[model samples]
Target chain A: MIAENVAFGIIAAAMALGALGVVRTKNVVHAALYLVVVLAGGAAQFILLGQEFVAWVQVLVYIGAVIVLFLFGIMLTRAPMHPKDSLDNDLRWPAAVTALFLVGILVGLLVHTFHADKIHLNGPVRTADITNDIFTTYIIPFEVVGVLLLGALIGAVVLARKD
Target chain B: MLLNEFLILAAFLFCTGVYGVLARKHAVLVLMSVELMLAGVNINFVAFGAFHNDRIGQVFALFVLTIAAAEVGIGLAIVLLIYRNLHSADLDDVDTMKG
Candidate 1:
């Protein structure tokens, strides 16, 4: 549908542009802020794909929690507001070019491999279907992830505790 | 679109993140770059799940979400710890651990 293409195009464009801001910005704080934009854009893209829950998680987790901690760390450290704090050394363009070349090659290879004919495509998994999977087949992993999160919380507290 | 569009988008995001990781010097920026890459992978997982009639991608994404949250938590904590010790978040100034 024309609607899907337009929505996808807009979200994709926003994500890509936000990404450029993330990389191109010299200020670390600004980069962190730009990351919020990128994450939000990605969330919008996810929603358009019909994964409303995932989109909410993307917004809630990345924007709400991760970025808040990121900003807190910046403040705690008195992190430089600008990127000129240190390490102005630049990478050799040739190296950058080669790495980009490899990335392009890898992308091409992956595209060819996951091509449409190769994939037995199915329709978008409706909300009820995903709910069923979450409660039934994925119940174990769902619970296990809680344990993982607990470990992370403990680790964070331990790391932050000052001597 | 098919799986390939998601794959391509993920790849593009991953590559952009990689480039940012490789190119940036500041520690916090590096962390942001890593998160970008993880998000890209998460999108790929969800997309694949939708296309395959499996909920595995969503589960994988949930797992990734957990890891990313933890990663940011620990990363910021370490950043604070490092700042306490070094007074700077510059990777160049972090030579004490290198040699």
Candidate 2:
């Protein structure tokens, strides 16, 4: 559908621009903020594909927790809000060229994968089915992830605090 | 939405993150770049999950989300401790850890 393609384009453009800001920003906090935008755009793309579970998780976990932790660490460290030290743009040319080349190869591969005949093709997605599968087959790994988070929390606290 | 569009976005995100990691002098920004890359990987997971009509990619993305959260928690804490000792966040200034 025209609507889906357009939505996809808008989201993809936002994702790319946010990512560019992450690379172009001088302020570390600004970079973290740009990453939040990028993460949100990616989550939007996930939602556009009808994967509500993944999209919500992306919003909840990455934007909510990780970036907040990074900000806290930056604040706690007394890092210069905007020090005199210049942000390095030394490899800008080479890196940009590399990124462009990578994009070209990826687009080429996409074209190869989806021929013109498949333009209007689509399949089904069901939230109920995915939920059932997660609660059934993925129960153990899901529980383990919780335990892993606990371990990580304890370890991080131990490593971060000093006597 | 098809998988290829998601793949393209993921690829673009990854390349940008690579560029950021290489270009950023601030250690915190470098960590942000790493998170950008992880977000790309998460997109890939959900994309595949949708295409195959399976929920495993969601599970995988969940796992990745957890790992990324843990990574940032530990990484930032370490950065804070380093800044406490060194009084600077510029990567070039943290040579004490190298030698």
Among these predictions, the greatest TM-score belongs to 1
lDDT score, residue A40, model 1?
Answer: 88
Separate DockQ for every predicted complex? 0.57, 0.60
DockQ of 1: 0.57
Query: Candidate 2's error at A16, in angstroms?
Result: 0.8
Q: List the pairs of residues colliding in candidate 1.
A: none
| Per-prediction tally of clashes | 0, 0
lDDT of 2 by residue, A11-108 (tens): 88888888888888667678778888898998888777777877888898888888888788778866566767667647767877877787788778
| Cα lDDT tens digits for candidate 1, A93-123 | 5436755886689778976787663234344
Off by over 4 Å in 2: A89-101, A114-128, B97-99
* CAPRI docking class of candidate 1: medium
